[model samples]
Target: MTAHLITGAGSGIGAAVSARLAERGDELWLLARDAGRARELENRFPVARTIVGDLAAPDKLSWALSHQELPDRLDSLLHIAGVVELGEVGELTPKAWNLQLAANLVAPAELTRLMLPGLRAARGQVIFVNSGAGLHAGAQWAAYAASKHGLKALADALRLEEHDNGVRVTSVYPGRTATPMQVKVHQQEGKEYDASRWIDPESVATTILAALDLPRDAEITDVSVRPGR
Candidate 1:
């Protein structure tokens, strides 16, 4: 079975993707923010293993994972955990910018750097669950968009750097998905959130699975998923 490490497995799209992979009997390594969260993930995914590493503290991921037992070879590394706060450039604080950057951009880069050996050994793939903000920064989305934009750059650069190593990279941009994150975004925007108006997490999970199961001859470098309704 394929072995994959996933961040943000606690909820939203990450939870959907992990559940689907587990259904197919794939091995999963779920990254959690702490020991308490790790135990929760262990309970949620009884057959999967948990890695305790706080994405909010990107500088410490190396130390956190070094002490854990990682898979010998990884088929995929899914970077899906993200934190966002909607604030205009004039009001967003440095701490707010740092929080989003650390979790959404720097953490993925660091985690990927630490896992390159395993990914290279298996000729694996890396999937970044980006956002529509990655492509366009709207009003009150400066900091969040900046982090996602950096994530897009990271994915693009990694794809080129690792192509010769037989590793593929994909970026999935889901537009206003009906996840808890969206709810928070709506709250930040002072708007009511309606779940039916956005894309489904399972739908995005299916899109991600398609990229993972694609033919070796072709690669899905980037995909945009929008709500049909």
Candidate 2:
């Protein structure tokens, strides 16, 4: 069985992806910041392992990575941990900007680097759940856009670097989705952001799974899934 490691598996798209992978009987390591939620998922799935770590903290992430004992090398690494900060350039604080960078770009890069050896051994895939905002800029989304753009660059670079090792990297840019992060952004902006009109989390998960199921001869470099209507 292929082993899959997922971050931010406690809620939203992360949770949905974990559930889908478990349903397929793939071995899973659910990494999240909340221990209670991780335990709940473990109880429900009964076939998944849990690791509690805040991706924003390098030391904590490194510690968790060192302590994890997987039965086999990881065949896939799905990075779903990201944060969005909504504010104009003048209103953005240094702390908020740094937090966005830490969670969205730096942490994912570090995690991928730390796990590269195992992925190489298994000829695995690296999946990045990015945002449409990363492709097109928006007003008052400077920090979020910058972080995601950086993540896109990192993924592209890694893909080129690891191509010789037989590791494929897929970066998925999803449009507005019905998730807590969308709701939070709507609340913060006080705008009537109709998330129901956007793509749902399950559909995004399906796209990700499809990429994972592709033959090793073919690789989907990047994919963007937006709402139909």
Candidate 3:
């Protein structure tokens, strides 16, 4: 059976992807910071395992993976954890800035590095849940944009480095999805954000799974999914 590891599986796109994989009979390891939410997902998907740890903390992430007793090899590693802190250039505090980087960039990169042996052993794929912000800059998105851009770079570099090892890397740039994170950002801004008109979580998950199903001889380096009118 194919084994897949997904981070930030507690909600949003992560949760959707997990559900899809489970339905396909794939063994899944779901990682999230909220134990309660993870447990909820575990209950929903009896065959899935949950790992509760804050991805923003390097030590915590390391401990979770080391002690969780995962399979010897993984077919796919999905880096879906991310944070969007809306702040202008000078408005970002040091703590908040670091946290954004940790959650969005550092943690994903570290987790992939730690799992390289398993992925390479299986000739697996690494999928990054990047954003359109990573590809194009916008106002009042300094921290989020920087982290996503770094993630894109990381994925690109990993693809080249792992090419000889037969491990593929794919980055999915999703435009404005209707997720809790988007809702929270709208609430924080005290403005009406029309998320219903945006891309749905299931669509993004479908796109990701499609990328994962590509032939081993081919590599879908980058994919951009956007909502249509």
Candidate 4:
């Protein structure tokens, strides 16, 4: 069975991806900020193992991983955990900027580094669930955009560095989805939360799964999914 580690496996796109993988009979390691959420996934899918850690806490993350008996080889590493802090550059606070960077960029990069040994052993695939903001920043999305842009760069660099190791890195840029995060963004912007206006999380998850289904010799470097308005 394919072994995969998925961060932010609690909800939204992460949850969708986890469920899909479970149905495919893949072995899963679900990492989430909320242990309860991870447990919920495990309850439904007996093939899942749970790891709870605050990604912002580097020491805690390392400790948690060290304590676990992770798979000896990992087929896929899905970096789906992330946070968004929205504001124009002038209005962005230091805390907001730092949090966004830590969660969206630093955490995933560190986790990838930690899993590199296992990934290399299996010639694994690494997928980053990025944002359209990574490609272009808007007026009030400075911090989020910057963080996602950094994530894109990280994926690009990792792909080039790991090519000789037979590892594939894919960066998936999905447009705004009907997730809790998007609801929060709508509220913050004083706009109504409309699911119809956004792409479905399952749709994005399907795209990721399709990429994973490609032949071993084929690699999908990047995918951009947007809702048609």
Best by lDDT: 1
What TM-score does model 4 achieve against the real structure? Answer: 0.95
lDDT of 3 by residue, 71-107 (tens): 6798999998788888778788988889989999999
Residue 21 deviation, candidate 2, in Å? Answer: 1.3
- For model 2, the superposed segments whose C-alpha errors exceed 4 Å read none
Write model 2 residue lDDT over 44-103, tens digit each, in one string: 668998877677785578777677664358899999978988999999999999999999
Relative to the unseen true structure, what is the C-alpha lDDT of residue 165 in candidate 2, on a scale of 0 to 100? 96
Clashes of 3: 0
Residue 111 shift from truth in candidate 1, angstroms? 0.2
Q: Model 1: per-residue lDDT, tens digit, 43-162?
A: 999999999999999999999899999999999999999999988899999999999999999999999999999999999999999999999999999999999999999999999999
Pitting candidate 1 against candidate 4, the one with the higher TM-score is: 1
Q: How well does candidate 3 match the true structure in TM-score terms?
A: 0.95
What 10-residue stretch in candidate 3 is worst by lDDT? 58-67
TM-score of each: 0.99, 0.95, 0.95, 0.95
Alpha carbon lDDT of each predicted model: 0.96, 0.88, 0.88, 0.89
Per-residue lDDT, model 1, residue 164, is 100
Off by over 4 Å in 4: none
